[model samples]
Target: MTAKEIFDSTIKEIEPLYGNDEARSIAFSLLEHIGIMKTAVLAHQPMETDTSILQKWIERLKKYEPLQYILGETSFYKRTFRVNSSVLIPRPETEELMEWIIRDFGSVEEDFSEKPAVTIMDIGTGSACIAVTLAKEIAESEVFAMDISEEALKIAKENALRNNANISFLKQDILHDFIFQTPLDIVVSNPPYVTENEKSAMQANVLNYEPHLALFVPNEKPQLFYQRIATFAKKYLKPTGVCYLELNANLAHQTAELFDKEGFTEIIIKKDLSGNNRMLRAAL
Candidate 1:
């Protein structure tokens, strides 16, 4: 078959399962991967040829594999980063988190007298998206990251190298580690905030395909990671340092309360494009 035929066939087969737009996205991505641009694929004549690439992706999609993982890369903040089952696919909302950090820290770079190096630590830094993005944008900030999952850390480290981002990756269980090598200028995290009770509400693609360690927290203690990370930030963050979080909408108020109780003054909760409570930033 020609590339156009293959793309159409793939889209038809997967549309029933993933809907029209996502199916089209999957088809176009596969065609692109095989060196067939949309224009070229459309114009090419039909031919008797193998269609294994489309079939393989369809099979994976049937099992609920995320397209980003199937494609092996995803766009975030105008840059591409490798993604897989080992790490959560970077999302546009997370890009907003990076933008927020840059807006807050980029101004600090303007000081020329005894310019202090800002240190940033990303807790549960899956795929190192935030850390690498910050390091790339801020230029002089010292970025460090930690994750308990070895598989996730591996992918994160690879992404850091691929992006040429100077971030120090350490395999640490944040629940256990409370001290930092040095005081941090900011502590940011996009931790697992999806509570067990909310899993049934997640889309099938996310529920079945995304890594649970990076997506969920126990229902019994939904805000456990946030509490731990905030308390740690209190201990480790510089007096003027800030803590930023990409939070669960359901618990935005509670998450802010947690920070307030922890004595993080000047807490601010911000919503995503969807207008659900999505992120929190606070200063010590």
Candidate 2:
């Protein structure tokens, strides 16, 4: 079959599942992954077509499986991080959090302090995207990432090595262990913020494919993770240290309130590109 024929048929096949924008994104990604550029596929009659793979791809999309899982990697902070069902696929909003950290800390090379190393810990660090990225960017950063899921910690460790980011991977539950003898310069997290009641508000691709443990909290306690992390930050973080978190847009105020009760000062809410209050920053 011709490449254009394959392209058109693929779009026609998946457009009903996702709208034109997402369908075309999936189509173009598949084309690029298979080494057939859009113009080449359009110009040439045949561009080394693979029927079986194409059929399987279409079937998966029909089930609303995230393309990141299908592709086994996603772009984050101008770098690629491998992803799977074991970890939540890193999202663009998470990138904004990373950017905020990078901006706030500034580069170590730019700092003239003789003691330049900054200690950072990412709680519930799924995929280690934040830990790894900070390690790579901050230059003089000593980073640690923690996750309860052994599978997720495995992937996070792999990503740290994949990016050559040199972050320490610890398999620990943040909810259990609150000990930090050495105070942290920064603590960041994007822990489970979605409440059980909000499940209906999420897309099928997210609700079905993403790991529930990484995405949700009980209905009665919508801010459980934030509460725990914020309270921990009060004890573990340095007097001048800061914490950054990704917040559920619906509960930004509540998350900030949690920080305030923990005696965290300068509690502020920041919005993503969509203008939704999606991040919170606090200091002790």
Candidate 3:
């Protein structure tokens, strides 16, 4: 079949399950993967072919598999990240959060010293996106990351190595008793903040394909992770240390209130590009 024909056929099949735009993206992605072109002019040229592999991919997509998982890689912070069901796919807003961090700390090298030696901890570091990005961007920052899932940690470690970033990985459940051996200058997280009650409103690709443990909390205690992390920051973060979190937009006020009650000053609630209250920054 011609590239256009193949893409159109695929899009028709998936548009009902996903949406037209996403289905088109998937169609073009598959065509590009196999070197198919919209024009027969390109088809006349010798192109790579592995029909069996392509068919397998199509089958997976038909079942609503995320493209990142089917391909086993994603891009975050302009860098390629290895991702699977073991890790949460890095989102664009998280990249913006990293941008904020980079902007705030970029001048510290000249202001303080060549190697300022700041320490950061990432709680629930699924794919280690935040930890690795900070370690790569910061001049002299020591980064530590933790996750409760051993499977998730394995993927995160591979991602850190893939990015050529240095990060200390810990296999500890943040919900359980775990303490930082060293003081931290910054604490950051994009923890699971979605509530059980919110699941019905989520997309099927997300609700079905993504890990529930990394995406949700019981509706009865939606702020559980935020409270725990804030309490930990109070004890472990330095006096001037900063805490940042990617929050549930619907619960931004509640999340901000947690920090206020926890005695964190300068609490700032920032919206993502979509104008959703998506990130929070506070100083202890």
Q: Pick by lDDT: which candidate is best?
A: 2
TM-score of 2: 0.95
| Best-first order by lDDT | 2, 1, 3
| Clash list (residue pairs), candidate 2 | none
Q: If both were scored by TM-score, which would come out higher, candidate 2 or candidate 3?
A: 2
Cα lDDT, model 2, residue 131: 93
lDDT of 1 by residue, 211-235 (tens): 9988888989999999899878989
Q: TM-scores of the models, in the given order?
A: 0.94, 0.95, 0.91
Which of candidates 1 and 3 is the stronger one according to lDDT?
A: 1
Residue by residue across 127-152, what tens digits does model 3's lDDT show? 88888889988778889999999998
Give the clashing residue pairs of candidate 3, or none: none
Clashes of each: 0, 0, 0
Model 2 residue 28 lDDT score: 82
Q: Candidate 1, 188: how far from true, in Å?
A: 0.4
Stretches off by above 4 angstroms in model 2 are 108-115
| C-alpha RMSD of each candidate structure in angstroms | 2.1, 1.6, 2.5
TM-score preference between candidates 1 and 2, better one: 2
Clashes of 2: 0
